[model samples]
Target: MKKISITFLLVLISLIAQAQFTFKGTIANYSNKRILVKIDRAFDDILIGNITTNSNGSFSIPVKDNYSGIIEISLLDAKKNYIFISDNTDIDFSASITTNDEFIINIPGNQINERYQNYLNYDIKKNSILPQLQNINFYYNSKDDFYLPLKNEIQRISEMNEPDISEFPFLSYYLKTSDLIKNTEIGNGDAISNKNLILDHFKNAGQQFETSGVGKSLLYNYFKLSAMGATSQKDWENKIDKAIEVLLDEVGEETSRGQEILSATINFLNGYGLVNLTDKYMKRAESLTCEISAELKKTIQDNNSIKEGKIIPNIKFTHKLNDKYTYLYDIKTKYKLIMVWASWCSHCQQEMPYVKQFYENFKKSGGEIIALSVDYNKEDWQNAIKETSWLNDSDLIYWDSKFVKELNITGTPTLILVDQKNKILKITSKISDINNLIK
Candidate 1:
């Protein structure tokens, strides 16, 4: 009996040692029903789990055992507002949606996240030059007047936060990139000269940041900056492909770091409607030992499905006004514009007016518009439709709808142009492309 009792105690202790951590938090004014918990896997975001939030906006997500790293908890509705988690630590915090500044995060036991919050609070308080910086288009033209002040401000912040940022790879990379941009020499000349200098600086910085292992977001920004010099979409695609090739060669495609950079590059390009380059990059990624993520695999499949001549899969939607179910294939018209969007998407909201105007012209030419909303809340979806001209023509699918998954819709305002037979003509996120299709 004594021996059995000792064994049971030992087993209990072992189980306790391997227990997973719990993360619980409350978000005020956030009506989203679900929260996505993702861990940073190289340059990709691997979905760990989804937590169902209570009606009062409180959530609890369990961190699986043996996995300890930086995790991002994002509300399904407002993905931009993410709560960063570090280590396998428990966190309980309350954040406000109305607050434009830093949201208060109260972590009792975790020093890493506490430190991060402190740094974030400090940066938010000190970032006064962002508005001024936004006004200056540094890629199109160099403003010497804007450069000095921006450079000084960045330098000042780096100096002030050196102690706090040294331990954080993401913050360290950010400071380093800002310093590099500040120190770069810009020559006064024609637009071509200015663009060349900008591209050169970004390319140089991108090469350096590619190896940093800090995070994908910084590297993505660098790639965007580097591609800004391209004169057209085709030119941009060529430039980006060349840049990727150079990067792969420099880092060695078989290396983990090289695969990380490649993965991020592929995701960035795909997000910008650059599906033409995805196949080439994806094939290169497959050659590497690193396992391709399910999300990427789905993306590759989706890209293939919507290629120029392929027949798009039918999208079934229940109309918001009458609750009548309709199929995309059933809509017989000369041309059909299937727009996947959401109420929370600022870009979608901004482009709706123009889309309406284009639809007016397009309808006259026997074109049909099917505006799909992926809003989570029924009330929000209805309100969005009521506010816009889309009330008569809109259908709601909410989040992670079958249509969204089938179409591989990542970001909103995704425009798909189809012929009478449901054959896809063009797939783009740009509003200006609608006019081209009409013409």
Candidate 2:
């Protein structure tokens, strides 16, 4: 019986191993261009990979079969339409990749549906208002249009209130997103009505699955919402501290990929400048980040990347001439100016010549310029690099790169100057007064 049990366990492991697949394809119809692709694991932004295409549009990528629930491939074409990949495998491009093309891939009945097929098919359309709710511009512009979609969705689910509906894992996710949107939008909207609805839903959702693993994850979201919803700065600070305490207490109980959520929550806390809330949690976050950094270093060893200071995450790009991959790293000089820009941003375009002029003088006086492009399109990034002769590395990367987010850069034409060791010489100096720094 013992031998049989051991054999069964071995077979289970073997089967899991065998359920792996690889995707290989070519991206063509361009003389010289870079491509960025994001392979999402179903609903969440898990297991993301950014790759560049060769000059001739030939490319290949490897993804975990289990994680590649519904692959989304977005191409950055300046004159052409974006490319999206939404299927399992075996990709072959059409003969021509031209500008006037509408290209989008749709994968129906995907893994999300497969896994949760047993649950009733809840129409995600009502919840689709999320993208708008999340859009900073839209949310600010049309707060009236920003209805409580999550609240409605949850109410629908709660109305059923069966073991299955209540037990569904996605309920917690909806609740969390709803909570975040509400808290972020609180005083900015019809305060009394919106805030009350948010608070009520927050309590209702928490009570439903208070004892589940997913509920544990919701605690972080709950505290995050509380932090953002506080009436005053003092209120916000205290709520954040309380949230940190709760997070620290429950940090150890997470299982599976819960550690990832834990790390992200900590990163959020750090970004909000609430690190002092819980020293123990701060240490845990730092330790986890260091561990993840070590693993990333091993995985990304070629680049002169290091885990020190507040360095941005390195993004991979395929060399134009040679299809080999390379990551852009911040080269420390006597003084360095880091410009965060996007091709689509007019302000960024307008600021380029001035930045270039600054570079011309600064280099002479011992300074360096590194412009990081946040263009979602790979071709646009390459095109912008060619059009603008800024004295900087041409290794254009995606905006979704962790570096941009780490720097807390939500606006374009934002600049940061650092010393030789990359210390903050200046946070963001005026474009006109930038030269004053070195002088």
Candidate 3:
């Protein structure tokens, strides 16, 4: 799993899926625009592919997935996404203006998507459209000729059965969770009841749900719902703790699912400025069983060093800085703010100035900045750091070098603070983490 980015989803696909497959589709009236293919990894999205539509509005890009999985295709110009489910074959769709608001289409060759659309249409009418019509009947025109036909049509569709997806287990899991999400959507009546329902679903969400795309949505929405009406910081954190604690009761910290949910929760909290809660949960994760998969461990641990209080060595850089220092050992300071980042990362770009400011603030007080670039292109790195003067170097190997392997650089803008003696003082991502540790 990659570092948590925007969107919440999970797709723990079946074992028979291939590492790479083609996802081809046509988008009418949307030509020559960038399209991003992405998958849910609980806390963040894994960008599988990026391609621009042809002048004819058609696109075909390679996607990494198992035979069966879920992915979201993002239209950069339209600012919209269409969710798709796979069933071991190449999944294709034909889209246009008529399907603008409705992304789901049950066209030829995609029975899984058809069934999913059936549920989506059914739920909207029964829960949203049906309720609105009932409001009109009770208040506006109960005896009008227009009312009778409209009511009957709405009633018929609302009472219709949901799509039968018994044969496809992936579709079944997705839709069932979709129904629960609809029930707990914001502005639904009975806030108290919906909150309890969210908590209950959090407890019952198993690997089938956690490993799929919608799994992340459950946790994402729960965090939003919990913080909807907080009057105080204590209340906000208490609500978050309540939901997380409920989930922990069902899954232990040692299990993969447990670690995933916990890691997702921590990343979300940290992103939203709940650093204290983030620390509390991260410490808890660190103490769990270390037998989990290495890829999964990156999401939680976010580093490769012997955590805190340990001497961190093997800090190597490829180029010389100002024709002087090349590694952490060469820096003459009591504390070192080591920044591991890539030029292409948007988040890293946003946080660079603050790190530079921090380094300047502490420069005279025994501090130095050592930037480790994971950029394979030297020009990109040079352009990125053109205005800054700091110790910069890279192997230009991009996550495959021994330097990255030894450090286990979790994600871009991975900022760590260590002393001259190579003792790692802190491992953090945000300025708040550094300030919190130093102060």
Candidate 4:
């Protein structure tokens, strides 16, 4: 039989089971501080591990594959309390005060935390409940009281819990605002056919996570982002050559250096999906990033491991803004972005109006965007850059900033960019891709 149906479709295309789970337990009243157990790690940010509480008050931590996270337990007589864990469910508890006690025995049941909580409930119903119902109809003109709470938050992201349409970017920005609210002629006509039936129920809930193969790079990046927003240059070069042959066979069998940095972020999203479908797909996305940097410079010059471009890894951080701070090859910028933030981040306050509109359009086409502010506070980084006028070159580094301990930058709206001989063209969290270096 066709070789047992091609060995059952290569055992169902390498069934990625156990998305992660085994948060071994024991956290009972810090027998001298050391709990930091963080977990959210599949593709960057959050994975510190530690456990110490035995002088009669246990502590243990290990969690992977039932993904949804946030399990902080920091101790010194209890105050750190971020606990949301959904899916591979074991979480033993007992945190006390007035003479302390903390315990969380064992937790396991992660069917990849119901598939990373249906890709974080379809990215909190397309970036926080349909962009907070278009910012409450752009400050209250009530689209019939925000259209049935935006179809009950797009039916709570079509009943969330397994919706990993290949790292769904808010289910491709709610199917590109449901084709501009379905072939325009703006708003109501039954609220644009109930916003095109909640973007045709997130395009049939992304074909049930593309029939459970968990979003083959989000179904070839929502068909090369709906054929490059309908300019369909030959259907966005046949969906960026089937999403760069399934992201170059999942970035050459990603055997986890965190899935090889999510296979170099699916080869920088297949080189920005062939630089948005042709200058011959940006010369086949710069020849697939020069054939993965000439097969990682012929496997690092056949294992001598340090030449072909040695000037690459330097990113540390720690300049501690004022109390005397200046690291990051000690300040000087013709062009620099460095950015990174945290003041109880709301996507670092919605990426400060796209990094203050790319630092006022890269300083009116001259460029320089420092910003730093890891906020240990010099008045919450001068009241969030004086309520976000965000004129560039602001600083306040703290969080141990020698460019965040040479770019270990755990996370918080990370940026980087650098130039005028600082070199690095991008590190990106995509605030309008730092105008691809003064365009």
Candidate 5:
């Protein structure tokens, strides 16, 4: 019976206008590198800007005029990212990649970051060493000569705790719910042995932490692991229902917080490829005595929109890829490929040329490629499609376009294959897989 605060259901997602601040840094060995700055919005990221290091590997960029909180730095590759908290002070840091490939950051004149960095270093060490030691201990005989010292070291490290920098209130709460911490029995490769513990953590973690990106990850990972542990599909479905029941227990059923939680859970399931579990959420929401909000209901409806064998909504061609094809349904082709792409995504750019090359063959088979751009800028969308004559259009709403969410275009270059009736035949990211489908 832990307390779960319902303030905003997202404290970090909404940018607060704190006193202006900037983050100054130096990256070792990577000079003049383009970096992607993003702020956490629950499970999603709002792109801040692109920054590049100077020749000396030094860079300075203001966090944002009205934003201060959790930020992600994607250096070069999208995955080689690190997190930092910017406060009232000008934070300075020096960073480099470790031999083990962990991003090692050290911020001077900031005890909060100092403590956090120490914990990251410590966590990486523990993650690297402990599991192997666990296997050794599992395999070796207790009477072995190496057992005593190895066991003692393992015990000491396991008992050791991160330095208490809880004096910084927000960070203290953040660490509690962060993906790096296993107090919730959930993280990468963490087995969900205790479902109650995760629910308890979600309940106990305050509004600020529980409503952030870390919170979303915990819930997503919990469901993923739980789904794996289920004895059967029926068992999995039951667990999903039971989880929602416990989370909503004794809480204000009519409140938006409950609704937001349900919405987030549904999105998480969709992101995790748990299509069947997503259907259950709408069922649960609809059957409830209290009226579900339009937003929540819309989320459920959108998720169900593009299921396999479901006829997708017919789209008007605002900027038709082919001048001959005025609407999505107007195409006389036997099959269609809905290429949901964005202009800014490098991966999408790479995929476009291949898609263009494949279009002729696909068209010969009575299949047409309908390019749907998810760009918010009309000019950008136009520039991107200059080379292709596919039947296409962009709402210019980025991801907020109704169909983008409905069709579940989670990333750029998502290919949705459908028949003449627009019944979704296949949805995949790989171009090679769908090549066989067209033939």
Candidate 6:
């Protein structure tokens, strides 16, 4: 019994030892003092570790069991190198910052990485011919006329390299799936026919190659393509919802990939100001059996706060000119335009004039403007106000303001429109589109 217990302990220790991995590399002409090692986790890049290079420009990063999948080694101002890492493997590579050539990888007795390096070399050679192929476009009159020759050239290159891809499953899968996506994107003729082709490619590729990074990217692109088929906003919402359903069915909801797809879809809907659809999708995501990431959960919560039809948070601020505190609810107008701006934002500087014009036209129709400055320095905020004649009622609050957190103001020049009862109506960043909302 004593001997058996000792053997079991030894085996457990060996397994644990095998789980750790190391990556060491040397950079030629390495100007950067530190190198960052990041692991690609679905839609997010997680920083696993960092290494300060020695005087000889060599660095080593020890990757724990927590990191898997694609690894990226980023050198400051230099091109990044990507590699697939597994347990117990020590991957060594030498990269040159001056050249665009592939890194010289040395993973002793790893056939997969060896083949990958060879494939990368071949791919680089193929890419070198792309400029010449693009030059073939001079013969064509228009972009529509150039598609056939370009497609033919792609087919020729794919066929010529068939032998090289025979042993590499991942590369083969990437090439075929990429070709299918390309065809779906460039397909000509009737809109219905194009839509059918896109759907067919998506359904087929998504089912067959739903396990890799490339596959996830293809599926995401498929969702974008599906959105293009919609003729109206209502149709777009329905189509996007159906696409999400199909994706959830293809890749079960209890997976990282599934959560990534849901997060991306929610972000897409949010970008277009489709608050209703975004909320619906967020609810669907939450209802799933999968573990929701904290970041994604926060995103859903923040978006819900400013979603249309939801009441705007009652925020009080002391008006800079009057030095009197005013509640947002006290703003007596049929509609309120809250413009979040900062003195440092160049985009805000450019859009201020258009916003001024919109406010002039809008205030005449029972609308009110509240120019809120998020600048940390009170003097800079005051000076910016002096430059503008249209800003009458302005407030200043640094980033620490509770209203900033409630609104989730990520960038400057954000426009939020609310009705008299403080019911959120429209939220957008495009200041020029304020006319559409007022009208």
How much is the lDDT of residue 96 in candidate 6? 61
Model 1 misplacement above 4 A: 1-19, 27-37, 44-57, 75-79, 95-102, 119-215, 224-239, 255-257, 273-299, 314-336, 343-368, 374-380, 387-405, 409-412, 419-421, 428-439
- Candidate 1, position 234, lDDT: 82
Off by over 4 Å in 4: 1-84, 87-237, 241-316, 319-329, 332-439
lDDT against the true structure, each candidate = 0.63, 0.49, 0.69, 0.47, 0.69, 0.64
What tens digits encode model 6's per-residue C-alpha lDDT throughout 1-439?
9999999999998866764777777766664366667665434455555556887778877666643345666554223445553324666766665456444454422444556566665665476665567676556654676678786875676565623656555546555655655555534344446546544544444422433344445555566666776899789878877877776676555655565567766766766667787778888877766577765677677777777799988776655424443677767788888888877789988887788777677878898777777664456677888855443343333443456766877667788899889988887777766677675
Candidates 1 and 2 compared by lDDT, better number: 1
Query: Between the candidate structures 1 and 5, which one is better when assessed by TM-score?
Result: 5
* Tens-digit per-residue lDDT, 1-439, candidate 4: 9999999988865553422444544434545444545543222234345455677555655464544434444444223433434334565444433443444323222443344345555666776676666555445444677667666665665565545445544334434433443433233344335433433433344322212222333333334343444365666567545544444344443222212323333434433533343233233333443234433333223222111222224433333444333445444556666676755568888877777776777776656565665554355566667755432232243343344434545457777676666666666666876666566
Give the residue spans of candidate 3 off by over 4 A. 1-21, 62-65, 77-79, 97-109, 134-152, 155-161, 185-206, 221-231, 303-439
lDDT of 2 by residue, 1-439 (tens): 9999999999998865664544434543643455555543211232245555666656666554643223445555433323222334344443335465544222213333332332323333233443433443333332445346544544555464322434334543443444455454535455444434433443344322222223333444455555676798789878766655554454332332334435445444544545364344545544543334332232223111222234444443334212322443434358767777778889887877777777778888887666766666656677787854444333344456555545655467678776676655554535676788796
Per residue, candidate 5 scores C-alpha lDDT tens digits across 1-439 of: 1233444434534444432666778878778776666676544566666667899778776665654457767764354557876444567788876666566665542666777777766776587787778777876677998898889878877877877766767566676566434543445454654555566665555556522467566666566556666889788877776776667673345766667678777776666567677777767776778788776787767777867778877866655544576667887679989888888889887877778788879888988788787776556777887887766687665565545765766677788899977788888776777898776
TM-score for each predicted model, relative to the true structure: 0.60, 0.50, 0.61, 0.24, 0.61, 0.52
Q: Cα RMSD to native, each candidate?
A: 9.6, 11.7, 10.2, 26.9, 10.8, 11.2
Q: By summed lDDT, which 10 consecutive residues of candidate 5 come out lowest?
A: 1-10
User: Which ranges of candidate 2 are over 4 A from the true structure?
Assistant: 1-19, 22-65, 68-71, 76-224, 228-231, 251-262, 270-281, 284-333, 345-361, 382-389, 394-397, 400-416, 420-436
**Candidate 1 per-residue lDDT over residues 256-276, each given as its tens digit:** 455556656776767666766
Show the colliding residue pairs in model 6: none
User: Judged by lDDT against the true structure, how good is candidate 5?
Assistant: 0.69
Q: After superposition, how far is residue 291 of candidate 1 from its true place, in Å?
A: 8.3
Ranking of models by TM-score: 5, 3, 1, 6, 2, 4
Report residue 422 deviation for candidate 4 (angstroms): 5.9
Using lDDT as the yardstick, the better of models 2 and 5 is 5
